[model samples]
Target: MTYRDFPMPAGLRRTVPGGSETGGPEAGGTVAEPAPAKASATVMLLRPGTGTDGLELFVLKRAATMAFAANMLAFPGGGVDPRDADPDVPWAGPDPQEWARRMDTSVEQARELVIAAAREVFEECGVLLAGPDAGSIVADLTDPVWDEERDALLSREQSFAELLIRRNLVLRTDLLSLRAHWITPELQPKRFNTRFFVARLPEGQIADDRSSEATEVLWAAPEQLLAANDAGEHRMLPPTRVMIEQLARAASLDDALRPAERVWPVLPAPVEHDDALWMRAPIDEDGNGLPPTVAARNGDRPQGELPVMTPWTGGPLNERVTCTLCPNPSPMTLEGTNTWILSAPGADEAVVIDPGPLDEEHLQQVLTDVAARGARVGLVLFTHEHWDHAQSLERFGELTGAPLRGNFPGAEPVTDGELFEIGGLRLRTVLTPGHTMASVCFLLEEDGILFTGDTILGRGTTVVAHPDGQLSAYLDTLEKIADLTTGSVTTLAPGHGPVLPDAAATVRQYADHRQERLAQVREATVGQQDRPRSELADLVVAEVYAEVPRNVWPAARQSVLAQLDYLDAGS
Candidate 1:
């Protein structure tokens, strides 16, 4: 059946916002949606490339059975846990009160959410954002006391304040930067007021993904992976999908990082179209320091209000999300990420690329966009298997009754060179393995929009992770993309960051960067005694990337090991 006929889940009736729980038939049947809630704080983690080439991000595929965005790709983060607000969590960077004000939340709630972000990141991704002084109450991360203390906080057994005083640990509040904010939409049953914060991974610790809510995890370069997802190859969540699109627009992780330093104002999804939903550079109440397009659309119109929608205001028609990093989408506020709606010319139906994270409000927003176009989603496309890119695969498919499409080898694996048409646009899949064994790239034949999932990017090189990712395979993929330059493959629409005009040159730069890193790695290991892969990496990274943060050393070591393996295999 087409999406219009897709049956809603049992008990999935719309509700009026002001209705009583057990009153009128309308209350039990359907009710007006409540305004979305506003949340404070977003936490993002970054890892240096495991390969010698560039940086990557930690991502995970949420289990399909999850209540939130079932079977979607996502970064490691969630709402703030109560302990996050504890003053005892230890503050290192910015004050929690200031953070709350910047995020537009109460100081107490802000503290908790930040704490929760830190706690959740460690629990889900195996990366530690907390510092060493955890407390005399808790010996060390490995110590049983530490586990007990952590569990007590996680389980709500002990207050964060108690734990803080019991242990001398302090929260490194300075480490976090205000990245973005997203309010849940008014149409959905489950909602969250989420804050996005960006932080670099700690040095020496490896991201040990817990196989619970997240079935798998890995570090990936945005451009390369997004390229795959956009081609309907990889799956991703909305936030992850949009974040990568923004990352692709950056020239380097450093360039992308500049924005992280400034405190970003949190913007909520307009409850009613009449409610204001526009975002721009943070404004001071004195009516000064406003960026152009800051006040693009002000005034609560109504639910599903349409004002020449673009990625900056969610995304375009046919689920065509605009890259937040792109220059075209105006009055940009970090409402998470912008999604695109893809429609092939001459076709009545369209394909939804990067349905985005499994946010309840966002899902509704996409549906509104879809309804506005009077088009049904024919298929769902993923850039790659990264959580941020493909997290919403199942939900989008379920909601739209559209079949999932992609070439990556997984539960619903597609083959290389697969092509599908919708609304005059054509998405051709190209198997671009390296970021992961199943990575793929989609070339939009119509507009020269080549969606390279982690294969190529407008900025920064893609990482070649070991184990799941291989340097040899990634390099080969880069070469294959560069070869596209000889033909019509010109503009690159990556899964993460932004789109690129000179696709061929970008691919060439990626390849050269890898080669240069390889040379440095070889030189670093020339005189050192043989050591474990991780140990050897410590030596090599110090020589190759003295400029990168030290917290990413483990990932670097992984890259060096992958290279060593490639050399040993002589492939």
Candidate 2:
């Protein structure tokens, strides 16, 4: 709505939605220096669409009565206001300096662009892209109080900074992923330098049709929009159309949010196509100047060796598997718990594994993601009852109205060989009791992949957990997992960290690490078996786990205790 001709600063030419970018009388007409493009931001707001993993992107059709890019479809965005550069604006996520490097702009300009992106979306659609803090996103703004603030922002009576500070909120830049940069071809009297961004529809927030510039606002999946455009149903620019093309390739909404590795700027130029005038840019199919190397989903030595995994924020692992990273990251919880959803291709029913911790936002994220997939939670299964994995169990049951089953206290009983068939997926339970007496793994009969809860991790070694976990039983479970990997399993979706691409090798590495740690414990006890258990445990941890983080030494101590119990070491 703010784009009412989206008044921009002088410079950057405009490539009309379906018009020519070739400018200044290319056929020898009089020419003049192009005006400087106005600084602007465009948000490609996305959400899970119904009945599939494909994502729905939000778009607005500017009313023909409006000034800028009128009657053309665009995302929520507008020219940057000077007030947006205010240093006092509440900020969170990556700092301006980092954003500067990422967006190829000055720190001050980067700050303004980010704030403008967040602000324009709110002013136009009444959907705030910010929250009370960096780690949290506002869920709902349906209250009348929010409407008042939205009005204030739109009218410029209150600066975006003042509104945020007054509400004690911060612009959650971390929620934004910079996709590409584009400059209008240098022939237009009014031009724009726009930064394109993609962000998920934050939980609890909905896109309302309230913008002043547009007569239409809707959310449709990438393919749906493309098909509509092809049919002359939705008119759009090359940038918007190309972006939709990219979204069509995304396996899930999470995949769509992954930032391009290198964002080279794009300026649409006119090209002759089949004797017809066309606007073209150097953007690739993935919406970049070239193919992008997305952030690695695996940490150092992803599968073969035991090392902490990279921060895998979660995405579609395959056609049927999706991981939603919880917000609870720590030394113990790698990168927070990974709540997994399993469904068959195009099935209406799905199976959820590990609801994860009780963070309200996380629970809603999982639920919202499931809805996006357009699948009903047919069954909820827990790998174990650790709070990190099952704390939200009952709350999830309340959210989905689905049956809950697992080895946990309140869960209905499941057996080692119990098989479940849902939405065309065949999952078999493999009782894995080393991490806990009830820790289990689910083998996806179709994919030959195993959901190895905490019994095995994608990165680092899992704790036997002492009293609750036994080294002997755990060792046997590893062997079982290894045997499956040797046969049908190829990938491992761990409870924490990235998915292991090499399941056989990863399982073998886990088994070998356990044995190696046991050997170290045995050697550390030489002439020290007579020492007190605490002292001996500390000694073993210091000698064997010196390379591991001290913060996780307590968990290592548990493993040491399990090893001690198995070896009958110390009193």
Candidate 3:
């Protein structure tokens, strides 16, 4: 998308009332550099609105006495505390390492960001974003006793972690999904590198207007807030404005709380362009001219690419590993099929995995690369029978003069724990069948890298191709993978997208996501068990997957049907 950047003139009035001044570089006067942005976290607490309305977001008006964004409409948040980063904090939900990877920060920083978000929400609105355990949120915090705790927290008498521990509570970090990251413009005197998180307002918990920092607090539908901003009746910082605009698009609370496909850290800067001052941030190549803020919300921006050893066409990934990207790119395949070449250091023979679709050029490219490495193909392996990964299997076999092997028919079937030594490199097969009945993953024992073929994708969840692909079996398979290789596997070389550095965390997330989706599907289908199964699947998709793109719903429908089948069979 296109984003304009220009210098902020010294006297230009700020569009957002109560926002910091946009003055910088006074005409012909010495210019002062802006201060560094402090790390901060903000939470948008949301709940379902009355009747057919959408989500209502909790917003606060900062007290006019505040030094920054005084009288501005905003969410509950503030800078992180050193104690927030304490490693000993009893946490519940996704681990900090997973959050760290998702937020593009360190593990300690991730923990601190989550703690800051939850703590600030409680301090500003008297709503605790914590639970008594990993799976349950604390239902009520309106008692007078909680007021004392809140006061203690605000007064820094005890850290948030200490308060939770004393009360036997667990911070439900899982409830908070990162929505966006924004850095205040360079010209603003007070800048914050803020991460905005969205969370459902905990049930039975009332958000009181007890904060000394806020002049007012109210719950308003996102559309209403956006309308107020458009009419100049309400003032918000640029990041807040953008977040509200994005939230306004959601049709319901479920839609609003859908996990973001990607999070882009936007650093808006003022620059001189076209004889005028304007603000700009980097536009993603696929942004299609939408503003960077909007593009980020729409998931158009590529989050971050994996560290590639060679060009997109393929080359050496490391001293002993190489990969070639197949020339097929689509909505599902991401970049293309990844055909990896694995060999032991200084070895004369290598194993070729997932030769990919039967494209003559791609096959030739693979052969050329292998020959160039001076390593003859010793073993040709297939992760599955999927055309993207195995269509060229026979051709590859003929070209390399190596036997084809996999879990599929007409090849040497792979057994669980089956080991093979190819030129000093050790390989073992792990049966991971649910993406397809024949799907499998190969682990390089030496380096602890698992080559997962569609069982786990590089970016999004893999489709559980129904009929043949059962949801129950898939969940079991994911658990099996997690158990078999949690500590041993260091990286994941998937058939698509980028290589995952933390295999255990990624697998755990995948399992959690599936379980969450199953729960959602069950909740949506309750009391409709007597309906026709086919019609029920469509209904589940309509009710539970409203925010999913229409094009992908067909595939999602298959998954819903599988979940329904699993539920029905159990009942």
lDDT of 3 by residue, 60-108 (tens): 9988655457678999998887789988777988899999988889999
Task: Write model 2 residue lDDT over 97-216, tens digit each, in one string.
Answer: 999999989999999999999999998888787878888888889998988888877665789999999889988889889988877654343357899998888888988888878998
Which of candidates 1 and 2 is the stronger one according to lDDT? 2
Give the alpha-carbon lDDT of every model: 0.55, 0.74, 0.73
In candidate 2, where is summed lDDT lowest over 10 consecutive residues? 20-29
lDDT at position 420, candidate 2: 97
Model 1 off-target regions past 4 Å?
1-338, 345-347, 407-411
Candidate with more favorable, higher lDDT: 1 or 3: 3
TM-score ranking from best candidate downward: 3, 2, 1
Global fold similarity of model 1 (TM-score): 0.43
Stretches of candidate 2 off by over 4 Å are: 1-310, 547-549, 569-571
Candidate 1: tens digits of C-alpha lDDT, residues 83-169? 455565566667877876776668887777777776666556555565545331211355446556656654556665566556655
Task: Report clashes for each candidate as comma-separated counts.
Answer: 107, 14, 6
What are the TM-scores, per candidate, against the unseen true structure? Answer: 0.43, 0.46, 0.52
